[model samples]
Target: MKLAIQTSSGDYALGLIDGTGQLVNAISRAPDTAAAKNIGTLYSALMQKAGKETSALTGVMVDLGPGGLSSTRAGVSFANALSYGANLTLTGVSALEATMLDAKRKTDRPILAMRPSPGGACFWAYYEAGHSVASGCEAPDQLFSRLATEGKAFALAGPLRRIGTEALRATAAEQIDIPAADLACFAKTTPILPITNGTLTYLEPITNMDGAHHIAAKDLAS
Candidate 1:
């Protein structure tokens, strides 16, 4: 069975999924520190729930994010180590893609997934006709301005939904927030290519110093 770990949010989530995308057991818990303090606990819970040993894992999936810097790094690090320890292949999935997949279930309209960025902007990806059109980080105003000029009817999904929606509304653009659970649901269904064994890819760190510091504090607390 495929094992999945998502640490893109405040909580660390672990689950097992069969070939058909059926989630066997999923558990989530907040970390006590950025160094994967509660990751062990979550894994243990998942193992108990699934009634399986870690050595039996077929593949591992992890969320590579545009979220809290320290937490993201901690999560990715933990996943990397776990995959190595278990001798399992690993896959890295984009948080944005997961959000879009979740939003698509609600509407076929163009989707714009937005995650809070350190720069007081939002990391965004635009998916139209089931294909990615654009992906980048930009201020909500700038993004909404462009969408307004283009007259795009896109729904917003991800952590920055409120920020994106409010900005879009100010510019008279249509937008909606996709729930977190929906995003997780979409992730469970999507197929991802596994990363080469032993390969490590680091994501871009948050650019906002204050935001990074804030997340760092949270990470330390957790």
Candidate 2:
């Protein structure tokens, strides 16, 4: 069994995935309190619901997000500590990458996985044929303008905000939601890379930017 956690988007979730990459059970809740405090309760409840102990887990996965800074940090920190204490393998998956993986299963068109960012900017990634082509952070107007100019059909994933509606009109984009269960499913196959450097992925920069610059994951030390 593998444990999966997601706290990005200011929502917290814990999932138990069986060896077959199928979700056995899950628990999700809105950010009613600090993730640091709530995660333990969720973890306990999830394991109880699944009728399994931490020792039963062979690995752990977390969604590295550019969504909510405090929430993401709380989740990642918890995941790192749990994996370390339990001597289990740890793997991190970008929410954007997982969204792309989910979209590819339902559509063949190019995909744009987007999440709202701080300072009116947006975190986005473009994928074609199961591979990432381009990604960046920018305001909605600017991003949609670039997409409109490209004139390519895109299937959009993640939350559907007002900007998402405009993206549909501007680029005729299709909206899709990447469910938490699907994220857990995809996470089972994501590469098993331990986050040994005490660094999270592609989040701090996006959430902390001043809306004047864009940063990529590669720009940061792994």
Candidate 3:
């Protein structure tokens, strides 16, 4: 079984995936009130309710967020510690990618994935036929203008508030609301946070920074 944790969202989630039987158990909690301080508490509770032990986890999956900062760090730091201490494999999944996967289920057409970025612009990615064609951060007007130039229609998906769905309304695009459980089940992977960094400093430095900065997952993964 794999332990999947998603702290990227305002509401966090934990998932247990049993590949042998393709069985999954997903639990969602609002970190604001549920278990924000110590993710270990939440992890322990999930294990207990699922009748499993920490030893049962073959890998720890965490969401590398363009979502919440604190929550993202909480999940990553906790999973990183468990991965190092338990000798478990660590995998990181992107919140945007997971949202796109969730969007793909509802529509056969090309999907537009968006997430809030540091600037006023949003992190946007276009997926066609299950492959990402273009991805980057762009202002809403500029993005809309570009889409207009191409004359392509798309099904929009992501956190509406963060990405500002109002910009998508003119095209009459369909909005997708993917639950945390759905996103948790979507990731079956990670960017590989080096287990060496014994603190949470990396979490601040690594914020869905796009390709502009290098992610040392491969180099640091021992």
Each candidate's TM vs. the true structure?
0.78, 0.81, 0.82
Give the candidates in order of TM-score, highest first: 3, 2, 1
Clashing pairs in model 3?
91-190, 92-190
lDDT of 3 by residue, 48-158 (tens): 889888898897777766666777887888877788788887777767667787787789878877776666777666777766666766676677766766767678788
Q: Rank the candidates by lDDT, best first.
A: 2, 3, 1
* lDDT of model 2, residue 33: 66
**Model 1 backbone overlap count:** 2
**Per-residue lDDT value at 175 in model 3:** 73
Cα lDDT listed for each candidate: 0.65, 0.69, 0.66
Regions more than 4 Å wrong, model 1: 31-36, 161-166, 169-174, 179-222
- How far residue 216's Cα lies from its native spot in candidate 2, in Å, is 4.7
Error of 1 at 115 (Å): 0.4
Question: By the lDDT metric, which is better: model 1 or model 3?
Answer: 3
Clashing residue pairs for model 1: 32-222, 33-222
Tell me how candidate 1 scores on lDDT.
0.65
Q: Alpha carbon lDDT of residue 175, candidate 2?
A: 73
Note the residue pairs that clash in candidate 2. none
